[model samples]
Target: MPRQHITTHIAILGCVCLGLLAYLFHLDQPVSVYAGTTSTAQDFDSPGSVSVVVNKQRPLGDPGYVPAVLIETGGISLRQEAAEAFAQMARDAEASGVAITAVSGFRTAESQARLHDAYTGRYGTEVAESISALPGQSEHQTGLAVDIGASGGECSLKACFEGTAPGAWAAANAQRYGFIIRYPAGAEHITGYAYEPWHLRYVGPDAAGKIHGAGITLEEYAGLYEPPSAPPSSAPGKNAVEPVP
Candidate 1:
């Protein structure tokens, strides 16, 4: 072979090697880290990674007040029949002596923004950003979520009900009521928000059972649904942060 031809072939081989190295480097990027698991670490590592998907409904407007009495003292009024079923499940839990209650129900966009601002006020903008979702980003805006507990007390804003008996009971039996924990501990990697045991999302009995039984985040189960909607607002009523049993 001619020397010139041999030199040309060697140069081409060097270029190919450099190209392969660059590709591997790109694969090692932080975003690529998500490729490893159904629950990805990078998904919730930062605020920008969190994104809201618009489903059956558009994002909500400012959240109006629905007297706390209506949600906590009175009863959790639900627009969807599935929500009513959830209330019924709470009643059944009450029979078991669990004493379930709704702490937070439907929340409006403005209400959610206020809550977020409050958290940020105390916890700084960046940290607060991770712990709380923006108004439109919150499931509470969707009115499908209800924070449950042992009794009606202050639970909204931020409460780690996972440790209490009622919290534990709800965690165990939420599926029966068509409710899911939504965000479980250790899954901060998958869910952008922190672990919220009291946050129960109503997706119907079958979905709730499957999600709880499978031990996965709503984001993952979201794929099972034909389409996914936004999260619900604070309790469908007025504030005062009541605990959901």
Candidate 2:
């Protein structure tokens, strides 16, 4: 082979090897890649995304939007990915002596409207808005949020549930199963809801791990929270509706 041709081939091979190395690096640090470049706001903001941010300030783009794929688990429906993760989490929780039951999941717009109206009628609009989501603003309508409880229904949906065994276990271990207690204590200002220990939202393992480790609300993790000076004009005071039995 000619000397010049040999040198050119060597240079080309070096470039190819460098490219392969970079690709392998990306694969090894998938979350970094996801968080840095390839992961756009759209990934976590769209209605069907596992990491979608549904909150008072960020309602579903379509008021009547529903998840395309939902599956039943424990007599409630969740997006397929969330349902599968919840099933595994439930099994593991039971194995660990904490019985977690799904109390509510996947509310439709109509159902949310009905619940919100009932709460408004009973508590009056101002107070109801503090505890229940207005129609088109509830995360439950996204099919990614699940209201959970102990198997025997101890302290379900109430603030005291945070002290229950299932709640404690889930608070500690739910991120492993890609769930987060969506409205965590003292984050109501950012999340637009009070502490809801039983409300678990599936954001997939990577975001769940990051959110859990950072101890931040999804609104913060997703950069959706606004400071008081520049608050969102349409932000609802509360963004979750209590499950009505």
Best of the candidates, TM-score? 2
Give the poorly placed runs of model 2, Cα more than 4 Å off. 1-42, 227-245
Error of 2 at 176 (Å): 0.6
Per-candidate TM-score against the hidden true structure: 0.59, 0.79
Q: Write the per-residue lDDT of candidate 1 for residues 78-137, one digit (tens) a residue.
A: 435446666677777778877777766766668778888998999998878767667666
Cα shift from native, residue 151, model 1 (Å): 2.2
How well does candidate 2 match the true structure in TM-score terms? 0.79
Each candidate: what lDDT? 0.61, 0.85
Best by lDDT: 2
Error of 1 at 50 (Å): 20
> What tens-digit string does per-residue lDDT give for candidate 2 at 26-77?
6665332322323323366688888878777778889999889999999999
Instruction: Show where candidate 1 strays beyond 4 Å.
Output: 1-77, 152-160, 224-245
